[model samples]
Target: EPEVTQTPSHQVTQMGQEVILRCVPISNHLYFYWYRQILGQKVEFLVSFYNNEISEKSEIFDDQFSVERPDGSNFTLKIRSTKLEDSAMYFCASSGGLVVFQETQYFGPGTRLLVL
Candidate 1:
């Protein structure tokens, strides 16, 4: 029974400050992704990474954002500058199956961020 886990279940930050969300997924999974859900808004895709490189990213993943696999065991999403609009729940997911067939992504418990 493997699972994806996130750290700092919650975070509070000032506008314009930097923030990093962290996650660790099942050991054998290959693909990883980041998504966010703004309060009262639908979940939005931010980025996807594989083979030590980014595979896909949404428009929301702009110059202010970056993703990394620092030690081959943890994945992180860093926001260079926070904004009021950036307050939301961030999720991390991993899939062992291939994307061509719509593999199921196992999601971590979200990290809730609040910006003031």
Candidate 2:
């Protein structure tokens, strides 16, 4: 079965630097989303995209953050300016259908981002 994949399972960066996290969503999936979780916090939705435009976004998705489908299979998240508070487990998910039971977002293990 196809699965989502993320690169550099962990990332370390200096504050104020640009960081791009890479993800390869499941093949044939149409919807994509990005979420983050602080060490002990709930998973928070950042943004969801479909048809090349953002479908929905949470308040956490500020100007410093942006997402792109650079290619047919690759989805990327870029943080223009990293902050210490931005550190968290970033997850990439994709789904082929709309119904929650029939098509649930498949998540990657995660990319742990750390800023210091």
lDDT of candidate 1 over 1-116, digit per residue (tens): 99999988999999999999999977889999999999899999999999999999999999999999999799999999999999999999999966534888999999999999
CA lDDT, every model vs. true structure? 0.94, 0.94
Would you list the clashing residue pairs of candidate 2?
Answer: none
Candidate 2, residues 1-116, lDDT tens digits: the string is 78899987999999999999999999888999999999999999999989898889999999999999988999999999999999999999999876644778899989999999
- For model 1, the superposed segments whose C-alpha errors exceed 4 Å read none
- Candidate 2 regions exceeding 4 Å error are 98-102
Query: Where does the lowest 10-residue lDDT sum fall in candidate 2?
Result: 96-105
Model 1 residue 65 CA deviation in Å? 0.3
By TM-score, who's the top model here?
1
